[model samples]
Target: MPIILLLQLSNQTGLLSLGDLLLQAATVLHEGVVQVVGSSSAFAAIKSDGSGIIWGDAAKGGDSSRVEHRLQEGVVQVVGSSSAFAAIKSDGSVFSLVSTACGGDISCFEHQLQEGVVQVVSNYLAFAAVKSDGSVITWGDAAKGGDSSRVEHRLQEGVVQVVGSSSAFAAIKSDGSIIIWGDAAHGGDISRVEHRLQEGVVQVVGSSSAFAAIKSDGSVITWGAPANGGDISRVEHRLRE
Candidate 1:
């Protein structure tokens, strides 16, 4: 069990949730900047230095700023799709490289995004962001990826990470449990296997039809369609759990 601590400061008072503090510490430990690709029709990159770049599929590259052979630096994160790209910069600016109409015109692309976008993820049809505050934002096809209006309740505070399949998304909280939405048959119910999930799940990955989680000890647990997840017993020993 984790111990909770309360701290008081003059003129300013706030609750430092134990999980929040641990997540902050973990962020320091896993310090490398991350870059996600293969979301939209195009490709993009978000560097650790807070710069971003986009390329490919001119049709999806919507910057009227003149199609340059290369993009400027300062991208903190990038996501792609079959025809478009989206990026979040260190300054909390969100930009898109797609048909202007695809993201709702230049104004939409230029809108100031919420702060603290720690990670960006996308699938073939949409994009998702995991903020440092442990909240998630999603946009794209409503059925495929556009605005996760219906499943907002599935994601709550304490979510530490997220992964996207071709059409769905899964999030893992610090507690080692999982939550999934989109394409129900594709590992969405892995959370129901809570009894099998032990403490210390460190990471998760999603395939077309299944989910894989790596425990702290390096062992892995998988659930969903057996055929898509592969024969677990054969590689069980290779896992660290």
Candidate 2:
């Protein structure tokens, strides 16, 4: 990548130990930086050719040496959670690196993420990937949205979009039904308003610990910690227009 992109990455202040090498590299490179992404403690940069370089605190996603070979080519996009990085390749294959404690390890779900992944979203400590077949794959801290097994059956297919809150995840299926999981306090549990979320939902938005869904009828449904936007009865009358 160009020295300019590296310059931008430095601005994030996440760059560490490798600061010297990055600075020296910038002095000679004149190409272009394709992309740059950062986790809480590190940053990853993509070369014009789709390869990548990373630097920061090793334990917090600063290291990419382990997957250096895989990141050499065909990388289309890369994303980071609070402490991990996940890269998507041109073939639809996904590779995760660093911080196993925060969703970096993909070994267990290698089969599920092999190909056909269309989108990936992450919160503070987990990741949720949407496949071409409409299936969803989740991993990371189970308490922070990694374990979707609770609603695994509902994620089998028809999922059109996935949204994440700080400690939970919500999936909006093709039939307009909604599925939620993760820490209930973070909007992961929707049992309180389950009946109201059955269908007609058009979009879903999330706060750090809450979620708000707008339905086809223009009404909104919320559930989580009442303070985080899980309740709207106080302003319900004003939204009727």
Candidate 3:
């Protein structure tokens, strides 16, 4: 096996003590921490052997004692919401910790997530998974992109990528179009830019209250709440470059 290394094991400003503890345990540190993820008040890391280690606020998923058995090995990726963490294993299985409010409880979508997941993305209080079949599965707060019922047909297949803001989700289909859902004020609705979103949306980015799509022609279109990021008309010319 190769020797994995740690880069900034903890927050420099307020987590130096924990960083020191992690550094002092040279053997554990030597095992390697390949990745680290943090929620509002907790942190979790995955080791090279595919195991997960967590610390920080227990209520926010920092403690993994309860799910240690499942996360002992074979883990591939970890994602964090505002108050919880979810792990995806090599077999495509999923496990979560923390409160349901933060999307920690995903029992609602367990059947679809049994296997075949390729990626997972989260908003402030929900999670969306892209399956191997190109379908999407969501859970957590309904107002935050948890429920895809409104656009279930569109998300059934051909979705190549998914992005989430604090309260909404945007899916980029293979055809280069985009589908959105969640809070209408926070990137859920793109009707204002529907004309521009017809096709050729190469990329989509979001802020707390809006989403901006970069078209193939190098133009930009934005929609959602006007303040947080929706209104970009003032700089539309500059954005073209």
Candidate 4:
């Protein structure tokens, strides 16, 4: 018989797996597999049964109706945003369920969107997709969602990660440095080093008015208006001798 397993993803329990049950002879025997996704506004999971599910934000198509049950067996990755959800299938096709600009009587043909996407990310006002070859596609408001035409150079070939702030976006490369565009005040400039950009940054986060980066050593760095960036003095102290 084929082996069976169950995997659950939840913040409360993290990732847990369970195997077969013990038979009357005390011999372990597990039959079917089950996967449970617990209470999270956003959840992503790859089950032991080789299936996947992503659910969150009804307005963004978190409801089951948006995704075909048959496709669940082929899902490999999932991602969610404030108002949208995206999933990737084993075959590399991307599926999306999102709210239309207007409410009520929305048609799936009007809201359901798909593409051959390799990676995806979404913010409050827009969604971005990075193709397998490193080019990016975006939809939603050109201002808040991102205007790819502006940073055509950085989007070329070396982009490895993308981050969005309330009003702007940033892309990080395989190297330690970053390329920022939109809303200059939001730390879009790399000419001056801020505490967060001082160390070799591994990850970045964009808040309403600032940018924050996490160093490889697990320390955080932040820049932009102090009020919005959060006082990093404490973080600096922790990292300092």
Candidate 5:
């Protein structure tokens, strides 16, 4: 299959034959590029057939050579971190690639990622996944959110949503409570506002270093790095019921 590869040369211009570039890249052209995703240095495209083709910087997940066999088919979605990419298959399994130090290497959680993944989210250096059972799994640089040990128990059940910042994560539970972890200086440590997070946290949002939670009673709570957004003291009166 020949794809419509547009090219421009100094003296001539036309299609650039992918004779040796990609075997199925052309076949899926008619199916069209349904979706495209990129990391710091690479990009991946999801075709109509649910297969993925990747290209760009190998270190940023642009190279899918390592997971070529898996991307040949059944890929539904691909999400990228700063240097890695994670693909979710039709069967609900997840595959990762790119800089191992950033998130490319996920072998440690292979067993847990075999199946049941429903959604995945990431920041610049880590990845978090929500399982069908409402549980969350995280992997990547520990300081950036790879480790969830401190709040693992709190995340085991009834988790409705998980949001990420540049260096941390915040999760909202079914009971409307909030759990946070990751880089303490970057919004992971919410001890300063723990009392405010105990209940009624309807939604939690974050920036690169802080998080803001909205409660059912019409109040707001913030924590993490104060300079980035943690401190709402200037507007405290406005946040009251």
Candidate 6:
């Protein structure tokens, strides 16, 4: 495809919209398979007929034979983590696309993910879903932000956005408060900066192993591994501006 070749050019100009990419991808699927994607682990593809295909580490979402019926049509988008693949449909439903090793099997979460899921996000090994009611659902490796038991209460409702570090997740609520979970070593823990994140948080930026939240007041609070911008003490005075 000229588009693919052109994207490799040193001076490539203009950005491709999602619609453009999808159209181009559809064309490339004429032969059954061409567009391939990888996450921290796992692979997925959309065939010529708009059906989806999966192959990789079987335990990590490489196989999708179990739920092939639901994937025959209407798989609008697919995303994966190190644990499994998540296939999204046009009607706001998410399919757990893999085995049990890495959360590929979501039979346990089926009821919760049956409908009304608006968005889904992933880190290196975990997945989080944001539903229409403002609630959140999670699964995958426990150490990589898959578990949110600690802050489950806060995530019951009002969540507007969610972002992830390598092994942690940070969510911004409707009230502008921040709720985080996952591996504490990788930015999940917010105890040290919890008070400051109570309200007015406009956005949350996540690095490979840290997080920085910008409040509506223009102040910033950071956490996680100090070496990865989690500790901005040296520039703390400058941030006051």
Considering every candidate listed, which one attains the maximal TM-score?
A: 2
Give Cα distance to truth, residue 223, candidate 1, Å. Answer: 2.7
Q: Summing lDDT over every window of 10 consecutive residues in candidate 3, give the lowest-scoring window.
A: 1-10
Residue by residue across 76-150, what tens digits does model 3's lDDT show? Answer: 999999888888999997878767777987887787788999999988899999988899999889989998899
CA error at residue 180 for candidate 6, angstroms = 1.1
Assess candidate 1 and give its TM-score to the true structure.
0.63
> In model 1, which regions exceed 4 Å deviation?
1-41, 45-53, 60-73, 99-112, 145-151, 191-194, 197-199, 217-219, 230-241
Candidate 4 scores a C-alpha RMSD against the true structure in Å of 10.6
Q: Could you give the candidate ranking by TM-score, starting with the highest?
A: 2, 3, 5, 6, 1, 4
For model 6, residues 20-64, the per-residue Cα lDDT tens digits are: 654654554557653566654456776556577654455566556
The segments of candidate 4 whose C-alpha lies over 4 angstroms from its true place after superposition are: 1-58, 63-70, 101-118, 182-201, 206-209, 214-221, 230-241
Could you give candidate 1's per-residue lDDT for residues 1-241 as a string of tens digits? 2222111112235765656754553443244435746433444444465434443344654232342222354566566655566666666655565554343232432332546778777665666777777777776664544456666775646778888776667777777766666654655555556565646777888787677877777778887667788238777876644
- State which candidate, 4 or 5, has the greater TM-score: 5
The sequence of per-residue lDDT tens digits that candidate 2 reaches over residues 59-178 is: 888777677778777888888998899999889999997789999988889898989999999999999999999999999998999998889999999999999999999999999999
List ranges where model 3 is wrong by over 4 Å. 1-31
Query: Once superposed on the true structure, which residue ranges of model 5 sit more than 4 Å away at CA?
Result: 1-31
Cα error of candidate 5 at position 30, Å? 7.1
Worst 10 residues of 4 by lDDT: 20-29
Among these predictions, the greatest lDDT belongs to 2
Q: State the lDDT of candidate 4 residue by residue for 1-241, as single tens digits.
A: 2211212223355533332211211221133223433222434445555565434444444454545563447766555545455556666666654444311112332222344457766555555666666656655445655455677676776566778776556677666666666555655454455434533678999887677777787777666557887448756878542
Q: Give the TM-score (vs. native) of candidate 5.
A: 0.86
Using Cα atoms with residue i matched to residue i, what is each candidate's TM-score against the true structure? Answer: 0.63, 0.88, 0.86, 0.56, 0.86, 0.80
Among all windows of 10 consecutive residues in model 6, the one with the lowest summed lDDT is 1-10
Judge candidate 3 against the unseen true structure and give its global Cα lDDT, from 0 to 1. Answer: 0.83
